[model samples]
Target chain A: MTATTPAPSAPVAAPEPPVLAAVDVTKHFAVRSAVGARSVVRAVEGATLDLHRGRVVALVGESGSGKTTLARLLAGFYTPTSGEIALEGVPVRQRRGRVERSYHKDVQLIFQDPFGSLNPLHRVRHNLERPLKLHHGVRGKAELDRRVRELLERVALTPAEQYADKFPHELSGGQRQRVVIARALAVEPKVLLGDEPISMLDVSIRLEMLNLLDRLRTEDGLALLYITHDIASARYLCDDVVVMYAGEMVEGGPKEQVIADPQHPYTRLLVESSPDPGRGARDRDALFDADADGLGEPPSLIDPPPGCRFHPRCPFAMDVCRTQAPPRADLGDGRWARCWLHAADRTITQENE
Target chain B: MVTQFVPDTDRPDAGTTSARRADGDVLHVTGLTVEYVTDGDPVRACADVTFTLRRGEILGVAGESGSGKSTLITALTRLQRPPAVTTGGSIVFYPRDGGPAIDLVTATPKALRALRWTSLSIVLQSAMDALNPVMRLGAQFADALRTHDRTLTKDAAWARAAELLATVGISGDRARSYPHELSGGMRQRASIALALACGPELVVMDEPTTAVDVVMQRQILAQVLRLRRTLGFAVVFVTHDLSLLLELADRIAIMYAGRIVELGTARELYDDPRHPYTRGLRDSFPPLHAPLTRLTGIPGTPPDLRRPPSGCPFHPRCPQRFAGCDTDLPELVTKGGHSVACRLHEPTGRPDPVPDPASGPASGPASARTEGGAS
Candidate 1:
């Protein structure tokens, strides 16, 4: 049965060229107050990342951290305020005709809420068929039906005949999400970006979805970007991690290194705040009072902190962190962190313990 | 020590069932059932649910979306409106400060109005929608305060309002700002402050942190814990995220298909889960420290309450299902410090042979230990 199934995504191979790459991208929205003075809401500040085939890189951050805006920039939904994006080494342009169509065909985005994303009135078959026809130009009644069934089967929605006739409301949450995934796969995109794809799902089924995404990366070689606030799932599924705070990338490295020994104070707080089942109640009490270690909210994006965006909430904030922005200090072995604490000359002082 | 559970033999009753309260229990719920009366068969949103809320202790209610967590909260607060009815069970709320216990299920509207904000209050989900969008944050507090106590002057009420906001880490001056002007985290903190304006002895929070980001959620939870410590009030925290409960709750109740499947301390539930359904839920999320392994999601969706499964509502999806599971209902029975409602722990109605003892307590292996307690 596995041999009979057709490949639904790009073929996997040794890492060579990146499927998607963004160079110092930025997105800003200008807002005018009631008095008419204008200011830019820096939703995303200069960020760089690459998505390679057969790899998953996660964009992890809290709300208002500009992760979503960055995802939109890569998906071609919005052109960057500054910087550029390339698809398979070719610069992506805001042009009409063949360029736009080809760019969209190679990239697909699966939204957070499956219930909201899928058309309520449309049947599963219609939702799957429409995307297939629009993207791949599949035609004729028999061929369309065959393609639709194949799409469902590829997503593990077996007995495609049974689910093809049901509407979005008729299926369960997990099943609905499967349908959404199948629709994204229908185009056979080289890259997939999921923005909190399983946040709306039940815990029991969420792991299954994450596993499915990992399987796609391993088997189909799709360059996947999983954007989420929950770090546990990011570590569980992704090969690399990028931690964002207030529209800035605070840390980026391999998942194991970053999670094991988070260098940035913000990254440490995130790890500390996340509820781990292995720990006991004393750890929880410590977590509750951990704010005493450093207590502040994310600064306003419109007027972020002058130096480090996270300095306002950082425990290890130094005088330099308040006056000058810290450079991305390379710790070698594909690891780096944005913090004054990692400065080359400064003696390492333990702030968290 | 393993305790064998004995199933309740009483015949099923379709109407309200009165329950005796446990001492020190702020709220005692027994056999609570709620149904949404739509055009078709009524949706049994909550069914035969039972639990106890202790004074000054944080009790966490964990469940999935359709598991009746929200409906159960509404039923407890006497906020269930038309199209939704509390079909059965009693909600006994013992007023703190040595006042008389009141049955909220049958409480008159006048009595409920007096009870709200003064003795008990609710912090609803979605802070954006919960606050009055057009009104200033202070006026909303004044409105809640004045509606409950007409004796307090407007100036005095406003003064108290500022104090409440301060308690939740919000500046008192921001009370003048409209709901839109405040950030999401600030608005949520203000809403919690308003809920505490009357110094309610018990606060019912329904997914109060669900919409916020993780960092904000952590801050809010920390503030709430600090406030609870200072004010000496019990809290009933409800959310679909069990991991949060494990971190915060003194006691945790796992609900499924509107039933209390398991009730125990956070340590007990996390380290030694009794019900198979509870085990499945605990295993659902990827543990940060545990070795990477494939998670096994429970098969099949929650059963339709209108025509719920003939026997155990979870039998269809339970991995340890036996011949008796499809026909006999299991009652929540307490042993040691925890309670479980699965046939695996029950001593009687042996329709399937028990598993080997080496499999551990989560499975069917059991022997000595005695006594029972209501869920």
Candidate 2:
């Protein structure tokens, strides 16, 4: 017998373009120390990208690349020092919104470690039920329990009977992640913000968790912002990719376009640097590190690189590149690259590699 | 014919094969059983796992968490403590002098210490954590040598530490540096030097390169290969990165639910993996170079070690699981040269009867996807 299930998400009407958009967004953090009077950690310099409806968008970069800072700004956990952040066509209230708690239901975050994210004393049911009881106005133990179980099942922690009763320590890394997923899905949030979802997990089991998330985004139609240092995982999961360099969107586009035909030097360096099971014989280490230094001192954002913020590390940097800030070029087909090479000539795309 | 620096692979006359004769393996582990004693019931960390590490050869053990890989390493190193008891097994260390091989399992506490660092050592994952933040790099190296060899004076220990610094690719200046001062790559190098302080014959490294950046990891791998060339000691290299293991390891072993599921030379395991679990694992991650190719991740999660599946630990996820798999656990039988724990292969003969055509997407003739690792 054929079955027809009710459509999961709301009907597409006005269809708000991108739940969140960074219009030339730049978040500069002032690092005031005893030694330095005014030094800015350009944590996130002129970064711009948009998170659209029902797709996993990966913000990939190394440790000091400002990926986390961007996530914080998007979460409204950190107020951007500069650059504009728009949510649903309306500018983010210029400050960490006073209605953050209320807005949290729409945009929920899941941390890297499930053990660290969930409290030890509380059970899985506690973590899941709290979001439902608070966000959905579900009162009564029975209703909260039923909803929590449903949430667990949605993330594929089936039966929920066995898992809901367990504590954080009792579950495996993968299972704990599923619980975290269930908790994030509790409020029926439109957006899911995942920070390194499976780094600490067993390498073999990591794929299973990634597949689960993929199903959620496709089936439930949830907008996902995947933040990670591991580029390989990002390549596997994200539909579209954003490469962040010292807190700026150096390159962003559809996964195949960006990953296959990278324009920005930083994006090329990052993709080349990470070890992929697919990339053969090429000494990835020498390919990436032989040129750029590993997370070497990023130029101060308060006083960003004289012209382009990336000129300092750009291998193909020229006098014009150093003196003049290159405008971001959207090279048709959802592909946008911020580089002098792209702005100057399309055919001159290949790096000196 | 004298055996030189040979890999642990089955092939005789292989290019890298050393002229040195096999001295009955440097490290022999048989029926190793370790259990973490919970409040009442003990969790089987490693059960009936068996393997051998030959002299001047690298043996790679790979598995997801709770696969008993770390437990097996811990049992060998005398690191497994009270809660994690070595229920059974004999970890034998074959000395160079033809002296009776020492059983690490029943060795005296004092003997265990004497054997450690000097004869058997470990290069741990997170060299930052392994190194004391407060102590200087040289000081920590000296401490390890002095603690192990009381005969060596302070001056002699200092000189040896400096030499070790050079051996591990760390400069003399780095000796005075703290763990924080050295970069991730340098710190890991120092840790390898520390493990090599007493010129250990066997080194047990657990995820040594997992935490570091890709550049540092490559540097570390190259350094390990260089050191092994000069030092002539066996390494028990453990990690989850199969591709890296394939590149570095001479022989590879796959662990699953507290037992060894498959063991073979790198060429054999990567080229023609026999076990369905091993095959599924190798196919999971995306390769680095090829961007357009679609990656295929395994569908299901590994079984819990606490109460693993009835028979085969991988039965639930195994694509070609048979009826016997539900009732009985198969032995880790040897086929050709590779050792695998799957009933699908006939232990008595080479080819086994093919069952269920609709089992898996990749159940074609073997060696279909066994070419180059990178797409």
Candidate 3:
């Protein structure tokens, strides 16, 4: 079969299709102080995202952008306060019913810190072994060792023998990251939700880890949801990108569309603010200053700016943005952004006024 | 329990300093050597490192952890302490006020302190440690002001503190806030404001934005750029992220082991990197524009600094290393306006101008490739 050659605005042809979907999901937490009743924290407010086989969908946002909450909702770790998450078109429910068990086996989540995720006292072999045994029902010491080695080798921590016996403390940052990937893969999950896995790594080695993930996505037919705050990394490694500002998907679709031609003011600010010394340092600095002067503090998520959560600090905020929430609209092609500027040759419209 | 580092401060300030430094280069040294006096054996930290920063220009020192980038910055700042001693090397800082040119390596504790916040201030990687946890941001600022000049009263110091915060884009209210109360970005900015609280002419920042995420990093960088424009302070910015260095610095110096392998205008260093090491590093970063390029990582780890490789420190990983590269240490020489320390760029042997494909895909290392007009 010939490879794809679509028009400029057309979606890139995929080797596979969607394997997991979170349809308009929302996860909220109640904050209760020592003497107070309860206050609602909209951890995730109506986030709809998808994970496709053999491709990567990057979920980009800064801290407190509802990324982790969204990840948990998809992983079945938290029941959505509203909305639904489906794996292969099946809604995620808590009970360990046979189908739910199988679904859990097929969709695994990769956490950011390996040190924090893994049990410190347990050896590497035991950590990888327990997951395989509980989910797959593998037994016998010999068979368990073989299965453990196979999992480690799959993640490229080669010789497997050397890494199998060591504890989490003994491994390097890159090795530890690989172990986390291996444990997640031990269940043979079809969809891998990587939540800022590379954000904690050394600059020189993070790319290597990302490429390994990219290889698994394309070669092994795995779907990846790489969650990160670095838009630059998201653009590089993801086929599609979603920019989340204050619990809503502000701009999303193909990575190229979102990064190269950002529609939302916040997305534009993120992409432009990065320092690229080679681009006439003076010019980049001037641009940085110009943008910084306008960006106030990130708003309180508890009491978000009425219309769009970003209205309070937006460089171009209209009165309307504070009163009413704007709808997510088509930003040409398959891409969508939730901002008034992209709404019908619209002037910077804010919901408040 | 502690040592004193003051040298001399009797010299009076003569008008503007950058204009009088005879212009070529102020901190001039050739074949400078430095080593760390570890318990058992001395560790060679910097060997034959040489470079020149013009009177008022910023020179970024780039390298990863243990790359000796921090040592170079600390050496310039006169803060290299215990175990780490300057085995050999001279850092001649041309004092602008008609004072005698001083050797930073031998400066006294008192003199160094006077030169410190007034002449050269350093903002370290840890914003938390740099600022006092217990003190109010206002008090800390006032303390710096009072230490520099005993004549300034509390009222004058407090007034200056507010002005400095405003200069750094922080509001007057922030002066009352403690370091912990402010966001990470705010704390970093406040620390920078305190560094500038004394009106230093030169600032050496070691991985200034290392801990913060990219967004905050960019904001902090923007503040630094604005501060430079307003205060006219020359900076020696050090960072491990080369991709970041591509945009914020005027000139960049790529360090490997203990010496600069490549040094040039930011554009030249990123677009046309000559050293094999530079090419290797450029390969490690995923470009912001490309969606599918598989970032090719340099296969092995950086060599152990204590037992550094012979010839070139990068020779261990150079994909195109030649026979002579293994035994001969290359010197940084200028060619086509860019200074590079690679045998390949020397006007000898074949003219190999082929760009390193390993750095990126067919269309890669897009350094300065995107002329962003986002404003």
lDDT of 3 at A177: 89
| Residues A181-212 of candidate 2: C-alpha lDDT, one tens digit per residue | 88888888777888888887777668778777
lDDT of 2 by residue, B1-375 (tens): 112222234322211223233475786666778999998678888987777677888888988877888888888898887889988766667776565567788888988887888888998998888999999988898899889888988878878888888876667777888898886777888899899888888999999988776545665676677778788988999998886776677889999898888899876676577888777777666544443233345556778777778988888887777677876787777655678888777554224576523332233223322112223
Q: All predictions: root-mean-square deviation over Cα?
A: 7.2, 7.4, 6.7
Q: Which portions of model 3 miss their true places by more than 4 Å? A: A1-17, A32-39, A95-104, A114-123, A165-171, A276-286, A289-291, A343-353, B1-40, B290-294, B334-337, B346-375
Instruction: Give lDDT tens digits, candidate 1, residues B53-121.
Output: 777889999988788899989998988898889988767787776566677888888888888988899
DockQ of 2: 0.27
Better of 1 and 2 by lDDT: 1
In the range A1-353, model 1's lDDT, one tens digit per residue, is 00001111223332466778887788999999999999999999877787888888889988889999999989999988887788988989865677888788899998999889999999999999987888889999999999999989888888999999999999988899999999999999999999999998988788779878988988898999999998878877877789998898888887766777898888888887787765644766576773542366788999988888887777677889898778776666566677887865544322210
Model 3 chain A scores worst on lDDT over the 10 consecutive residues at A1-10
Clashes of each: 0, 19, 28
lDDT of 1: 0.80
Pick the DockQ winner.
3
Question: What lDDT would candidate 3 get against the real structure?
Answer: 0.74
Under CAPRI classification, how is model 1 graded? acceptable
Q: By the TM-score metric, which is better: model 1 or model 2?
A: 1
- Quick one: how many clashes does candidate 2 have? 19
